[model samples]
Target: MRTNTTPTRKQAPVINFACPSNQSGLTALIARLSAAVAEVEKWAPVEDRLSLEFSKTADKPKVKGGVTKAQQLISDGEPVLDLPATDWFFHTRDAIEEGRAKALAEAAAEDRAAIEQRYVALLADWDAQEAAYNSKKPRGLAHAKRMVSKAHRAWSAAEAAIVDYEPQTLAEAHELLAYAGLDGKRVFFTPGETDLKTIMRNAAAAIALHGLN
Candidate 1:
């Protein structure tokens, strides 16, 4: 059997190799497509004229000139070359106003702090003065008690003068003592003076008697 061994027709090379020209054509097509997509992306609501100009350049590769053509188109025009004047002016005005407002607020805060500090200092001074006054002043009730005790001692000493002086009533003794100046003024009663309880008892009796007569 004559074997038909035309080496089993090897599958044609899977990859169809492209020529340099084909590769260049593909690169140009890709670049054009990219430009067209970029132009569409640049379309703006505010500047319809600029968008239309970009679109025209993107669609006509001849007008585009090359990959840098889109950038050239944007850089060429009068409106494109000169930045939006109104936007620049508005931003500048806004920056100035913001700075002024911030400065004013800072000044106001400083003024408030100064006022508060002054008031706090005044209060501190007032508190110090009040503390000094309180420390120096004598207590009225304590002073009155001391005076009353001294007078009582004097009265007791005067009473001792009357021997066998168990006066029937404290009131009678108070009357006699008042005449001797022992009821009101301070005096040195003897060292072995009457006890506090006895003095108080006598004083109470004296007040009662004087009230009756």
Candidate 2:
């Protein structure tokens, strides 16, 4: 019976996400928050598994050749004799689970307050940013169309008649917003339900870009 004396460890799970260049501080913070969410997902499993390191080495000193009970048993049964395969599985599992519940309760108690703070801050920041974006964002369809470009009469005419011109994607919307000389790309993560969408669609976006050429 071969046994390894290597100790237990916890390796963090990899998270894959990156905020693009020239993004606002909010986007950078949110990218980090995504990683934190991943860590939260691994938290319970790491607690359940890596916490076993305490069971493995808490009582033992840092001395070489420390004989575990299984090692002692193997030594007692020379030449691999009486090396039983079946190992201990606790029969009184409910009590063990009760202890688990108590342990997890303690851990959650320590973390829950900070988690709440994080949530509150995130919402507050989002509101602040949305307010700022809306403050500068042009109001009304005609204003936005005029912002896009008044250089071409026919292009302006094409855009002037449209009712809904919001772009389909955030990037295009931002580009359109830039043409309108307004700030669009910085704060928003998803498509907004505003007049901004008017310049985002094909007809309006094409009109904004090519402009009746």
Candidate 3:
């Protein structure tokens, strides 16, 4: 019998994805999250099969000299001994591979689930806030403007919630929040603030005139 005792080789790094520069902050984050989830889903099935194979075969006893008792009995009546079997080596390798695959698959699955939960919750919260804004009615033009301003504020806050996640997802999330003007700046129009472009432009002119005087 011939036995090969070489150690298992380590897997090489593969670059499966890279965020594009032209994508909006939110788009980039979403793309990355989607890729991560897809990878986990792709490998989960292989991991399951490997784990099952290991469980069914790892504990079975290995025969000495690579021969089962029945094979040894059959060999006794023959002129020469039959070739030794190599099941032991193959079984050992399978056991090791199964363990590795199971661990990697489980870890990836956890990360995928976390990102999905956070992403869904963020979308739901945004929809709920927008719906609340839409349901309000205004009695006059001035009130209507105020309502719009309030809604903008609510929308900004809702968008902020979309970027909340664990450290693993923070790099993309922070970029998205910064793009949405939620990174500690009061970007959205507040109640009583004049945010209409025409109004603001006229106000700027009035301020200049007053300064000259």
Which 10 successive residues of model 2 have the least lDDT summed?
1-10
How many clashes in each structure? 0, 10, 0
Q: For all the candidates, what are their Cα RMSDs to the real structure?
A: 56.1, 24.3, 27.5
Question: Model 3, range 1-213, lDDT digits (tens) per residue?
Answer: 001211122212222445577864446544554443444444455455554654454343221212333343255557755555443322333444453455456667657666555445444544554455444422243443444444333333322222232122344434443443333442331212222233234334544554445
Ranking by TM-score: 3, 2, 1
The list of candidate 1 runs beyond 4 A from truth reads: 1-108, 141-213
Rate residue 93 of model 2 by lDDT.
31
Model 1 lDDT tens row, 13-129: 111122235433223222332333333334322145443444444331111111322232254444554333231111232344454455456676657666555445444544554
Task: Please state the error at residue 8 of candidate 3 in Å.
Answer: 35
TM-score of candidate 2 to 2 decimals: 0.18
| Over 4 Å off, model 3 | 1-16, 60-162, 165-213
TM-score for each prediction?
0.17, 0.18, 0.23
Which order, best to worst by lDDT? 3, 2, 1
TM-score of 3: 0.23
